[model samples]
Target: MRRDTRNRLLEAAEGEFTAHGYPRTTVTRIAASAGVSVQTLYLAWGSKRELLRGYLESALAGDAASPEDAITRFTGLSPRERLVELADLVGEIAERAATGWRLYRDASAVDPDIAADWDELQLLRHRLIARVFEDIPATALADGLTPKAAVDTAWTIASPDSHDLLVRRLGYAPGEFRDWMARTLTAAVLAPDSGADTTM
Candidate 1:
């Protein structure tokens, strides 16, 4: 029952944060939406910042395993296949965490409390792409770009912001966006003459 209440509060908080953004969402609004008292919310999460953290954590708890496990899973794929797999994986993550990501990113500029989390999230994202880059063969990378540079490029193109621009703003369907990511990564980051093109 206690866990259920906590989940309800988190759900309400996520909805509030998504709708009004973190700066405008308040504990009272979340509490009322959750059908719980403000005190209950406070007891469960300590502060609105904590609630936001909880929401982000829950959103990121997708089907992925630990970093070690992910590395092991990617180890067997060929370089081109790894890039494709990484694009698919990153797309799924961005899709799941898009709401929280936007909320934290928007709030981080003015909210000192959210800034740290936002920075940490960005670091985590880069690290995930770095791991994928580690699996890619050195020969597969575009000329004149180091592994670090390649990883940075992959992170930028695969980001939720780009996904939102293409899918949400330009009206590309989710599958088309995913396909575009894989193709773009292949052409832009992989070896020259790889035959991958941005046709979609």
Candidate 2:
């Protein structure tokens, strides 16, 4: 089927991009890996850049419900509980999408189009983090910390860059990273009496 072929091409593109890096990855290699003709690969996605974009987008999306929808379920929980839930959600996303994000970050340095796309993705990520902060009452925020600051703190902590540093380079298990994120976010963003277990 057409959809199956497209999926295969995208998978092949991810593998090729991961194995060869975007600059060195070729359409021919991806096509060969996908068991498709070069023309078929071209038809599915016009160029290597487009193919990389498609693959990264697919990786970010995963097969679960949209992240926006997922965040809504954490509503009404206490601020600390919400942050802990958020850490879990972000950890899962980082596990799925961090590799693709790193690829995008690297490719963006050399490709104007990828740079633009990467900026857009970061903006979307910021907006999502802001939405999570919106649910936390202002009173619960650390003294002198504005809502914007709280969102920024969460955004930076939840970034793929952080995930890469802790998990890929430093060898943190995913759960350890998630727990660290929860504690760090709670300590940084919540007031002293905001019910955060900040002992660690």
Candidate 3:
């Protein structure tokens, strides 16, 4: 049950982190939430900061799948299908990590190790997605949609953590905005190769 205990600590920590934030959250509170002692938390995760890292990593992991694995999951699809899958994942991740990410990102800025790990993870994600976008069947048709630019642009609309605004504020459902995002990114990235002016 070691894995179970670790997961319990993590879940407890996530809740505490979300409620009190990184600076205010204490290992005692998190352990209390998990029905464990402060020492247990320290032994399990080393320190409060490490516990926070574990929480952030766990939350981030959901959204951190490589673009290729994501595309493969949505398999037997055309380039458009792959593109849609990629966009959908962005929506899923942003929706879930909306709150946790805000804290994780802010906390990382002050901690070199966390910041480095955060940057590396993000860079890996960007490159992986860019590779997929670059290898689309119509790469040569891209007018100016280089893999780098396409990846940047995709991250642009999808990475803003604005899905809630689009839905709750603007009144679009999750699926609606997700569809719009997919279509929009595909157009931008593919229009160049197709010689079509489908940018929005």
Could you give candidate 2's per-residue lDDT for residues 85-111 as a string of tens digits? 889988988888887999999999999
Distance from true position, residue 72, model 3, in Å?
1.9
List the candidates ranked by TM-score, beginning with the highest.
Answer: 2, 1, 3
lDDT of 2 at 10: 89
lDDT per residue (tens digit) for residues 86-120 in model 1: 87776776677878877877888988868988888
TM-score of each: 0.89, 0.93, 0.78
Off by over 4 Å in 1: 65-69, 193-200
lDDT of 3 by residue, 1-200 (tens): 37777789989988888888777887878998999888777788888777766676666567546345554554454566667787787768666666666776777877777778667767766775765565555443347566667678776666534565676569887788888888887777665345322221
Judging by lDDT against the true structure, name the best candidate: 2
Candidate 3 runs further than 4 Å off: 62-68, 74-76, 138-142, 160-172, 192-200
What is the TM-score of candidate 2?
0.93
Error of 2 at 174 (Å): 0.5
Residue 142 alpha-carbon offset, candidate 2, angstroms: 0.3
Better of 1 and 3 by lDDT: 1
